[model samples]
Target: MDTNAFRHTLTAFRAPRPGAAPSNTVHRSLAQRQRAAVSQPWLIGASLAGLMIAAPALAQGEAALPTISVSGSQYDADDVRPEGVTTATKTYMAPKDIPQTIDTLEVNKYKSYGINDLATMLDGVPGVNTNYDMRGEGVLIRGFSADSGDIYRDGIRESGQVRRSTANVERIEILKGPGSVLYGRGGGGGIINLVSKQARFDAKSSVTLRGGSWDNYGGTIDINKVVNPHVAVRLTADREQAHSFRSGIRNKNEMISPSILVDTRTGLRWAGQYTYDNVWRVPDRGPVYGELPASVSTHQGFAHPDDYVQDRLRVLRSDLSYDFNPAWSLRWLASKREASQDFDHVFGGTYCNTAGRTATGAACNYRGQLRQNYAWQATNNKTTTHTLDLTGRVDVAGMRHELLMGLEHSSEERQPQVYGTVPFGATINPHNPVWPAKPAQRPAATQNNLHEATSRALYVQDLIHLAPQWKLLVGARYDSYDFDTLNRLTNARRAASGDSVSPRAGLVWQPTAQHSIYTSYSKSYSPYGGRGMLGVSGAQDDEPRYSRQMEAGVKSDWLAGALSTQLAVYDLEHYNIRYQPDAVNFPNDWAVRGKERSRGVELSAAGRLAAAWYVRGGAGVMSAKVVEDRSAPANVGKYLINTALRNGNIFVRYAPQGHWYAELGVTHTSARWINAANTQRLPGYTRWDALVGWRTAPWTVTLALSNLLDKEYWRSTSMPGAPRSVLLSANYQF
Candidate 1:
């Protein structure tokens, strides 16, 4: 993104309150220009056609270049080149030098396939899975669920687990394994950073219309303009509606995201962004529990006609940066996020008795349905975070060192209201049923609570260039965390505080410019806060749960960085896992498990294989088990829930010098346990997909077919995979 080419929308920002930064001016000429890479060139898809036309400028008027028609960007070497990333560390580090494995999902690929939802956008990442359950959509990295705190936007934690929309997203970065040394309390799982597209100096705009099977359709508008050399603005909005393969389920989603960039006379570079999103959908419940009869089609749905889930969110983020010299700089980031959601669900009928048994203790001729219930819940969440990072370079005792010191403060308040379900007044056989009568009256509120938490942290890191071939990276962080929970239902309150220290160390040996070998150990922590911070449960008031990992890997670049590859093996353990201490006597008392362990290997490759061929995706194999839990001695050797043993995804694309291209993709996930008892499983599945597109100077059109075989399978323990589907997308630029 630092390149001369305007191929990327690169002015990303992280900041504190809109006006919290000092107004003092600093010289910018000598400071390293700070920019986050929000684009991946190889994924530009049909937009590659436009890049080829602009290649002359990228060439610097050098030798005669190969002619590329209005088709692809394979020959536009400079614009399509892969660049260093900033996620693994706060500073930019080349792909071959990162000690931790970070995987990226670029923008172009999803747009090409008409993907708009977060779960769909995350389809092929290795060691990561997306799950849609009654609780809401969630992401699991290496079998550990990423709580709301672990999902960040431009490195800032989001407000809550609201529905996710890609309308404002530019790209995604996943830092695998333990990373608590940076962010404070969170899931032990990896981090998911959603980078939003920022205002760009180059003027470009587009309008796209998309339509797909199940009556899915949407339109988007993107406008970027250079108001002047010192300022720029960008706006992107989308409106989409869709029907689902699950009978009777439907959706309507909307998003408006805008960003502004400013270069003040004081040498301060500032960027601000805002997003407002609203979503509504009737969720699918799949099938009744323990009743997956062959006669039931996957498309069957059992949701109540009136049941629905809706979420709305507003977020404001600002960044102010200044460069003191080529070797030193500082960036201040602030964000405020608010989310509100309401959910209502009705259960599908469950079998009540054996086919020939009756409630009266007599033999019966037919199976009947159990009485079902409808639940109502709502959440209101607000979060604010500020971070200041000072980065500098210096020579310490003849060894060059890259130093980063930072501090962060964040606060959140979550109010959750729960209304326990009311039983339906009627019942019908689940296997062959008709709509049952709705409950005549709802029940009293079961619980109402407000939870507030605040955290302060200081962290420091130094990357020492010990020699030309070796680099050592070391960092540590300390946190002061406190929380207050109010039981609104009973007008009672509880307060607690805890703290932890996390550390990381990594050594990179770049034996050659193209290849590097790295090994590292890192530790992180997760407080007692609930996954979405509604409250804390399932654990005692102890120090934050901690996780550690030891990893070794090799990274390499090919064809002058047009392609990148990595292979890594790791062993990770999470300690203080929650367990029941005395469920038989004290049903609410929860204790801790001694430990749980997971070991895995992963291989990934991205970028060009040759002029016309490109590849991206990876394969991961892991085995996760419960090491010890004295309270539950029977579970000591069982496999962890939802941790698949093997998963693989691969995508290959071919684009000629002409005006047409094609791609093929495949994904595989091995069966894994889904319950604590390890008695149920989410069946493994293999799926195939394909895409074709054609482009010209100002127009591009693509057709994508997913779930080509329409295989019947479950994506997670609770949801069924979508059957075969098709999408047709087109774009025009002005």
Candidate 2:
């Protein structure tokens, strides 16, 4: 049936009062009985008799309860039915029905926490860690790092290679453990999918302005409008800037995103989105070991040498879903993403010479032993993807079940250009560090081309119900990937391809209405790394390494699902792998023979504790030791990653029914080594942030203080400690 016709029928069917007697009913209308027979051919015997008996009530403005709500498929946390899981899984398996951990973060959570970025918000999730580099942001789950190919948006594959902002997200789902059975790539560690906000049936708009520390200021405007009953569009734009804090570094950012959704009268639902981001910054060059002047104290502030960087990114995606029937549906998605970055670094800007050769006190010279150097770098790439999925429900033996089948394909084209420049300078005396400058010399630029030979996958899963309280899930997937690269300078091209079959099995048992237990095993595969991370040789798919995981866990929900918790134990194996030496030491070199492994356990807990008070937190402790490192010392035994040992977080929230709210959060990170040597430790530390907010209709004011204690901590694997800073912001929604 068509959408409008279906809506009208449903509306009429649910409009009448219960037990109302029929008014226009005849003993038996031939047309009505014929239509009912055609619509519900499976109804028979007693069920057919019952429907016939109730036909008068239906025709008389007396109907049964309506299953559809104004909120669509979304439901309030407190209203979820017991033992009924979300359709995110074909069978609506309760959390317990899925052995692995799958955490869902709703839009309401982001509103309450005021979280606008994935890194900051996900920090509260258990087993999730983030590494903030000068270049961008990266995350690690369960001690394993995030891969570029593992990201998704609304069930569609996303490069997620851009590290700009997460303001456009409606919610985020972090599925723990390998998910190759469902999602083909980068499932070794797990995957985090960002679901973008959509234009709802109702129209809503908001605009916010904020200002904070370090000269940081920004504003955002988001609007959603329903042009007609079946069409809607949303637009968002924001800009932010910050300057000079611990060092004389400056940063600036701007973003614009727009999306349109079309709900047609036909059974088709579609949405298209486009995002543009640009960021520019001059990062601190940091200090060199033993380069200080005698009169200049370490505590004294100093400006960094020339360091500038600019990044631009663009993303476009279209998603579609068609409802063939109430119990069956299909979805198709397509997307394109691209990014470009430019960087320049200059050193020896009036360098000071004090004990330059030795770590000792000596006469300080402002000019001796000085030289100027410059370097330029750039990277550009683009990717396109397509996916088709079908979902349906079935019944066997007296129990109901769900099944999902799908196919995916993606192609990427990348061209990375490398360039460098050097300028001549007049000779200067040893007493003067500044030299006469000359025009900069332009160096040769080389462009390299890389192409992904389209990765494809087909998979199907079945959720079997043996009883009302028990379920079994069985699934398998066939994945294929091909890749090729051309060296622009050398004109060298190479190609490779491979495929794999993965299987998954699990069982869930619900001993009580609010609790469930399950165990499962799944497999995952990826071509070592995607085209971007892997060099020409590593891009070969001939022997794509694979990873396997075995997990079993229990989940509990109480207080009508307002409060939830999960406990899981897992063992992960990464095989047919290759390990490269430290990037800092080896730089661009590749490792021909790579083999390594990591195995460990993870734990986490989250959700609300009470109405006015909410608590969401998690802890991850693991023993992730590298089994082998061909370049490491023989007696080293294992390369134990200290950073993978432990990570924890906790948050307390208080919001009354009035117009005020407050929240405080504490985060802890364990010390990790910079490399396998284990001599240098990252120095574990704890930090806290707090906020107090007020809201009255369209006006919302907030006082936020991050790093309240101004603690000195470091997150850079290269740098030991990072100085603390603060930001205070206020925003208004209209």
Candidate 3:
């Protein structure tokens, strides 16, 4: 035979056939191949890192490991879904594995969408809305809402209590539905968890400078270091200054976040974090309109009406954990936070025709000049929380089980004082006043010096497997809260305490590898002391309320876990609620204990379906009604839709190595209505975002532009939505 033919025949004979190799040999060979494939991407990533290193280090900084994990929930690469776990508790886990509805936006997604603030980033989550106040920000999930400080950071409660920037966040996890079982009192419609960044094996550094419309300018620098093998530290800071497009509006903000994490090879870990925020703003209070629509324009003198407020906040946290074995671990955490704000505002009649006057005249002008200002009105608050969590996997009665048990205690104190002053200038003529002659006035002053609250809770849960395709979950929790408020201005005090034993039961069945069906029953509670205002006698009090939620859903995962779809139906009822006249302020003497119910169906999908194609969508249909309201009729139910589509290019080189990367995506959200009246409808909106990024080695850049169309519609609450904006960010590794 010829030499070529002889070699071909030998190769054919050496080719292995099915079932020809031993099981151990096959396993070893597969492991070796996976190792080689995983190692190749770093080599290429190294070259990219080298190119980015050439960029000058513009300011003060340090260095760190090349790789960092921003997905949160302490998960490894192969199990990226840990952040998805949800069970009406403070515990963190992957979203997909959790029995409840949970979603996440990691650092990559945040950077790609130009969402550096928690308020802006959370607006995209389904059934979640934003409320922008003169002093701070708020969020509503599943129709339940809270102010800034309700968010959690790494299972430890911090005092973000009001609107605070998300400058140090590594990832954001949003849990939909009620979650009061383990988080003490405040999880009416679920909770939002902000995961902080930690030092990794690959040391790295980064600096980003961004500028946009309305004279917006800002910068951020992040540094990380892996000191030796067991200790790592990271630091990040940001500063932003901007002018609003609305006439006479401006804002400035600065934030710094630093964290240190220590872990010993012997399985003991400790971590500490600190955050500081300073913000100032001058914005429009509210525009007035009569029966008829009006057209007005102003960018000049009196048109430059101004109102402003200043705020500052500080937060600190520490955590420690130890592992007894691969299946068992214990953790403890401590935290403290402080925040304050000051306000000054002036509203003047612009250069426009009065309601009854045909011309702009001093007397005919309907401009009832009300110059009210609050001076140095401070709201000081502090909270210290202690948490202990136990998580482990064990075998019970010839079956596998997952267990979570924890204890938490929190004490919070709030001191608020409101003082108002008249106009800054002295008044001239009572009839015809000069522009600069308006005298400042001192209005009334009131203070709440002793607004204190405390909560203690203990919760335990178990996930038991009964068969290959079935699992049952049982959980219970006990919570007790004490609330007290004393008004210095009135010398009045009211206090209350209540406790409850909440239980949950659920069943999950996975008949096939592609499908999971589950049904869960959960209980939640609420208190009626939100606004902090007592009427008539000027007393403070807290009233107790309760709720129960029953939910059933089926989830499907396709394309080898890349695509996920879920359909769920839920019925929730709230009873013993002290219905106040309104949400803003209530008379301390009046209490309306009533009942309300909300039932709905929800559908959602996420992840990639085909190569380079990704989709995320959600739709909700529900009826929320007040069953026992003497002052009002049953309100109509509103419909909502939240859907987005993402199509982009993929980095093929990373796939075989068990890595994933995307370059750009087109994301869009459907319109949603706020009230059942439907007369007040917010237009649907869309935007574009991109992600061509890497976390390790040299440097990586990600750029995002929100509201590409500059649509000035409302996304949540009573605030106008954001306009077209751009964010350019970059990170480097050393």
Candidate 4:
């Protein structure tokens, strides 16, 4: 039967109440049954029976059809819409049906373009700024700084360091806006979930070797095997090394992953995986505004050759699931991660003494060396998480519902120790060059601290199909947060605990088979000790800080689903923040109470424009400002730091059923203020990149070029951008 006939048939059914009637009461008139269905507090048998016969052939049929591969599908957006596993809602859903903006990045597809780093790979994403500096490799999403808290892997929060190794990642899912319902500590502006590769029944393996300019070289290997019908195993590993365009810098990276899976293919499944990554590079702190002399260029460096930053991470996870039937399932996830970071760098401000005076035994001209000092830090992070959820589909009073209920607990521990030298110990001449052989004196330990934080939350979400073309989504999460910090240097202790409730609501309307319009509002919270350096108590520190986001968007497919588009406008705000920095004398300190908000519009597209032409990319425009500041009223109107007013990037590729293909891409960002006071402006830039490749049945070779113009710009306010570079690579698939 058609949809209307099915819905009409549903109206004439009602289940008996617990104690009011017998089981045969459903044999009644249509009007009476409809009245009973609406008046009763609960729905049971009859409506569910009617839904079972219609659900598989109707709703799930058209709305959840399996993905199909067309021409150019291997390297295009053919699978961007499927999601495979939904990170936004933790439930099965169509990209259009969810009332949020989610962008999927296929790692292999971008690998073909010779982009491996997480920051560079996200250049095409809207509302994101790939502004990674030397101190850390975090980016800005929707005008907010995102670090380890907003990045995850395989449904687990990989604390200490964020997701940066793309070699083992199969796909990256970006969910915009607040995501506190499922992730208690995340989604203030958005969250990125890295999906790793797993063992497959199909025996597939590949090897890739590459080398290019500046002594860059790397190779990767992947092997998969199926020992039996119910068991599979896989191993993946990669290593890369490169010399920097900047002086006194070098880089090396390595990653290895192994996984095993036991799948009955119907009822029960289990999977276990482990990943290890080790990276080393010399950190660079580029020129400071108005602090550097005129002769300085992007290639010049003052850091000692011994300066370096190193990070090592090891993670293990186990996942198990049982499908009771086709409509219901239960899943559990557990993970443990250990990450360590060590860095030694030199930083300084002015060349001369403050007030333009000299203090050395032999007084000299005002021109002097840039006063600098050494800073070293070693941090160890340990994280653990456990999550359990039950998901299923049911019918209530003739309306279909997809439900998710879950509970999760996350804990993190960080041991940080800092060392710094006496001022002027690592000075360097600005005009002339005289390098000191390391610091004459060894730096002394400054601060040693240990921190621990934990969050426990229970969440529930329901998607109700109100009608054939309308849907309503509602969810809420309650979290209990606790934190403690001890300073080994001063023998000081600080502790805090609090609780919060985060809520989400959305409405979706499908006007046609190819288009969906939706609006959503969500809330997220910062748990105790959730910000930088954890939390330092203030008047408002007793309560958990909160953030909220309101968004409206449209998702559509064109050209018979070959092309997909997303347009979204959003208003996001963080409360109990925007306090003056001097109030706490530290960064990321949320003291007093104030407000900061960001309003923006974003548009994105991915698809095959023609038979051989594929296009992808988007743009974002935002107006972000401090609405209120309790400590400094004068700063109330200032814009946020390092956030551009307009940013966009696009990549286009042309490939046929032949042996050759080519791609050209561009990235643009508008001028932006480096400081929150709206001063220290940095010039914007546009960069162009191109690639050409030739492929055979089992071998593919490519040449990639970056920054054709070699224009000089800053990656962030604190770091200069890289110059033009090239890479050549070969891939063998078997």
Candidate 5:
């Protein structure tokens, strides 16, 4: 195939209109930009060095082009439309065909903007909010909290406490609404699925180094090799060490991932992957009571300089596929994941009351507004998960159907240990804190409790093409969860068991290949054994709580598939929420008589605007409220905590056929309540980011600035957004 013809086909859908500038002028301008780029001495030198390093490979006939295509359609290595998503139905389908709202962050988008972590990468997704927690980064999808257990890697559950690295990520898929039909025992908020880089038969290699403000520095290496026609291998690794903007806080992390694929001559394929990660950091809790005082410094943290938190993770995965015929295929996947975390730090507790001073209030100052630090609080947790899936596709009654059936089992054990606290002679004022010297002979922590949980699930889903312009999706899942808790201090043991079934249905109508309107309804459940925020246990007789959602959306492709846009409206309700009836007298007495609801409209657009312009952005308007609260009448009809009423983000980039490009972006979030009673609030804020880069074939350099206006704002309750910072990055491909 002629290469120019192939390029034209990709752009033909968005061809310039009549009466516009001649296409020849555009070609000439591109040529002029290339010539101008060549005049830059640094760019020329970098290009020459890259060519010299690749000369030997070219001489040996090992140098290959950046992308390869066969027939008239391009393959994975070259597709750039960003119209496909797999997490929604566990099958590759256009977003327009799916009946639910799903958002994706492609590797190119994040790489261009120099986003390095999962939290930052999710900035522009509609209805998604990010925050910080003592354990790890926290997220709220729709309106409910999604913890580490709610995150997945390659469709397998992974711990959320570990910091996520983007070095080995191919893309990030955000599945909105209820997902229990695929994943088991998760909140209704939704899930974040991280797709890892796969081994390519066409080999490629690259290395990148980055440095930024706060003494941040890191390096990543990605290498892929095709050993033979049947075997391919790929490896990715990265190391980062940095000091935080907060005083006495530092971070260090390392990750390595390797994958292999085997294709037999008999229409069978197999792949295997493994990843190891180790991370260490000093934990920081933002200002007291989620507020910054005039006398307090944003850069100061109450945690000791030596306090630290660490996480270690290991994962193994395998996949196999066989084609039985032109219309039939079978695929199976299995994975095992293990994770552990250890933390020791001082965190802000209750405000000291000097007037009511007693032995417990000895640390209080005369002001009675000081924050007493909880010292030597330590915890260790470990979890293991295993999963298996089998999927197939066939044609029945002149209709094509894709089916996925899976099984999952997970076991988790957590042991929390806290040492005796050492009282400080001087009270640490919230507005002004005085550093305290390290104490000698720190006490050893004894096991406080052992909590263990085991879960098993079976699920199946089918996508059926009912007609040329209509599609139907149906699915269900059954889960069995069991938990056991043993209190060492009280010598008490308790166990609980529960089961639940979740269901989903959707219908889609396509008036044209570029436009689709769809509606869907789904249900999700969370057993007591699942991550509980209220310290409730599964030992009770109460069954698992459930959530239901109804959503309708329209998806359209514009500019000949160069751009994709989506508009969706949804109503979600969560029931059987646990609440304390009387916190002052019966703090531990809880009842499941609470209900929450979220109604929202979301709009999103992504992909290319023109040959030289690229854009990705979204906006959301949501109203989350406590619908019913029999246990806490004061919170009835109140807005949900941390659920913003409006949020949006947009990024625009201009990159012609030259060695230089520039980008500008903005993110905005509306004010939100910080408590169930809606008494405290977090003000709204907007942040800006900019990027400039120059590239020549295998070498590229970039400068990225975050918080361009240096806005001082809170991202969550007390978590302040990072101040203005700059990052410089360089990449070389071989």
Candidate 6:
């Protein structure tokens, strides 16, 4: 990627706009209105208003009040609370004021722990789990699966299967529960939004080098410069190449991100950013059957050394904001994203029988129990998205209100040029595997297909302050989705279209600035694509699956707002789930009379326990089950697959003095069913991590040790936890 190309792209969108200055009369009117707003006693106040209201009631005699200051960092040590999050309401509001469970991880915090991967960074979040899928990394939130499509960058949906890097990330925010009102055509599992770093008026630069076990090595550069008082530029880049613990696996990645910020005297500001990423890695399927005996090593990967997947991503975004007055403002955002992938792999199969093995010998033998099945897929997938959002805030009838309206258009296309499925000529034992010789020629390519989808959506949300201590939120969205599929082999084409509407409502009450109680209800939907799924071919296609959630929570700040805690309970259900009645049946074997439900309680706390000790962690207890399944009656009342009854993690850091600190953390996950039938299970496991670091004026060094006990366990059904590994990093700042 050329740095000059980024400059050209940004200049194309920076055309000047002509405007007239406000007249003297208009300025006078604005000043009078600002004065009136300030005089209103019941209007929205700053965070300190809560402390002042509770001081008389909660403070002891002669006890001096702790001084507090609002800093520029998203989160400051003075108060563990975040400045605000936009994903929940499309407007900046404190996390405690939002009626949903929102979690945030600052870049500095994760960097200190030597966490590089997105999945590892989310390990301690309550009610969230990592799962594996053929498409990409999968996330389970509140017992519902959230794919890559559910992830967002700066509030815009990011599609495709690719690993995310934190080199240019400022913070990561997770919004829990149904989100269709703001994001269309998604699951009820919530969304993950990555906020990128932007240019500031101040000049800053840093470089970091990291090395770890498994031949891991990487370097990153972040540099920012202020061109003038009104303009600034920033660039972030990184390159990494490494081999994995799994045999025959290697990883490589490179990324470059450039951004610019422009501020005009007319109260208008624009921020533009572009990112390019290229990633190549050999995909690992982990051990077979979701488990391994002590005699079998977890590093045994079945995929051949030649199998690999490569991905490239490009994203461009622009945000514009103007303040009309002290009480009114307008914001507009536009973004475009393109992603492509190339994959080719031969993987193991899951079924084996003694009779077939005897007849086929080497070809049919699959470790004695499972049969050898070889699958190969070579295809190209691309996704292009364009989105626009308009948001405004004003005071109406002495009440503060924020309004958001948005439009989105997206298209995705997949072309599969080559696909092959056949039994390999050789098989090996799991306990003592033998390498097979490479085939002279690749398998014949037969099937060719193309799939494309286009979607459009309109959404609106409003946050109204009914009183000084009370607030209400309401939102709705309508989506239109169209999909087309063409089979080159059969020359057959199929098209489907569907529509959905989602709505949400919430109410919040803040008795004091440090305490809040709230309840909310929301709805979400996922559309199904195919020929008959929507009655396009004179057959009843499956209707879109719908999910609803009802939640109540209490949020509070303690120790003079230095710590924050939350307790929440929620009930969520998904309806119209498609289930297969009989595996042998040809058509009409699937039905939509299936439902799944999950109810859980979550407790979390993060912040400073004392002046020298910092604590962050949370726990969740969930009960998830298949409430109804007409097609597969036996699955009714069974536990949901891959969902644990209990999960939690806690980390503590102590920095009594000097420039050195030590940290310890533990993560625990309870046993969970591997399948919906609840027959096979993955045992519960616990892992420990430790970190130590020292900082000088311009240099910092750190070491992180993971899996301190060398615990051997299954992270997911087919994914094994990594063995003990160590990472050391050094940073230089200017």
Pairs of residues clashing in candidate 1:
14-333, 15-332, 15-333, 15-334, 16-333, 16-334
How well is each residue in 554-620 modelled by candidate 3, as lDDT tens digits? Answer: 8776666666667778777766666556535645454664666666666766555565455554555
Q: Which 10-residue span in candidate 1 carries the lowest summed lDDT? A: 60-69
Q: What value of lDDT does candidate 1 attain over all alpha carbons?
A: 0.68
Per model, state how many residue pairs clash.
6, 2, 31, 0, 1, 7
- Candidate 3, after superposition: displacement of residue 424 in Å? 11
What's the candidate order when arranged by decreasing lDDT? Answer: 1, 4, 5, 6, 2, 3
RMSD of model 2 against the true structure: 11.8
Runs of candidate 4 exceeding 4 Å displacement? 1-85, 112-114, 161-163, 352-368, 420-426, 430-434, 439-442, 533-540, 578-591
Per-residue CA lDDT of candidate 4, range 1-734, in tens?
A: 00010011112222321112221121233223222211110111222323322331111000000011111232232223332225677653456778989887767666754566787777647888767655455577887766647776654665664336677776677888888777786538888766676565543567889887778899888776667887677787899888778777678989987766666766676656667888888776644644665577667766666778888888765555677876777766656678888888775445564345443233434455676666788888887776777777788998878788887777778887777544545456665546567765546668778888777888899988888778899999998878888888777777778888989999988767677789999999875477643422212244555789999999877776677788999999988653435545653345655888989999988877789887778899987788987776777878887778899888787878777888888999887787767767878878888888887657778788888788888776556767888888887766
Give per-residue lDDT, candidate 4, residue 157: 61
Tens digits of per-residue lDDT, candidate 5, 1-734, equal 00111122322212221112221111112112111111110000111223323331111000000111111112111234442345677554545767899887666445544466677677657898876676665788998887645677666666434566666676677888988887777789887877676565543577888888999888888776777887667777889888877777778889887766666745566566667778888877644444334556677766666677887777665555565654445554444455656676666544544464532435434454444454453444444544444555677999867776776666666665556444434456665566576566555654466777777778888878788777899999898888877777778876778889999999988777667789999999876656642122223333677889999999876776667788999999999876556767964466888799999999998667888787778999999898998877888899988788998898887877667778889999898887788877788889999988877657777788889999998776546678898888887777
Q: What lDDT tens digits, residue by residue, belong to model 1 across residues 218-285?
A: 98887877777776777878899999888878989998877766665355676666678899989776
TM-score of candidate 1 relative to the true fold: 0.87
TM-score for predicted model 6 compared with the true structure? 0.84
Per residue, candidate 2 scores C-alpha lDDT tens digits across 1-734 of: 00010111212112121112121111122222111111111111221233323331111000000011111111222111222222234223334556677766544334333344456566646667666544444576766666465555544445533454565554566777777787666647777766555444443567766666667677677676667877666676878776645445677878777666566655666555566778878754433323334443323222223457787877665555676766676765555667666776543323435444322334434334433445566666566666666766677778766677877666666565555434223323323234353335546664455554567778888877777667788889898877777766787776767788878888877776567688888787777535343322323435556777787887776565556677878777666665456656864444534444555555554545676676666677665655555666451445444344677776676766777778787888876665576655567778787777776655666666666687766554423233344444444443
lDDT of every model, 2 decimals: 0.68, 0.54, 0.51, 0.66, 0.65, 0.65
Give TM-scores for every candidate, taking all chains together and pairing residue i with residue i. 0.87, 0.77, 0.75, 0.85, 0.84, 0.84
Clashing pairs in 6: 50-513, 351-371, 352-370, 352-371, 533-541, 533-542, 534-541
Report the lDDT tens digits of candidate 6 across residue range 1-734. 00110111121111111011111111122222222111100111122223323331211001000001111222323123344455787655566668899887665556654455677677657888776554455678898877635677666666654566666665678888988887777778788877666565443577888888889888888787767777667777888887767777777989887766666746666566667888788877644554334455778666666677777777655455565764455554444556656666656544344444432243443435432445555445455444445555677899766676776666666665555556655656655555576566656657667777787878888878888778888999998888777777777776668899999999988777677789999999876652222111222234678889999999877776667788999999999876445545644355677899999999988777898787878999999899998867899889988788999898887866677778888998898898777888788889998888776557777788889889988777666778998888887776
Model 6, position 507: C-alpha lDDT score: 91
Candidate 6 wrong stretches, greater than 4 Å:
1-81, 112-114, 289-293, 326-330, 349-372, 378-381, 384-386, 417-421, 438-447, 530-542, 579-590
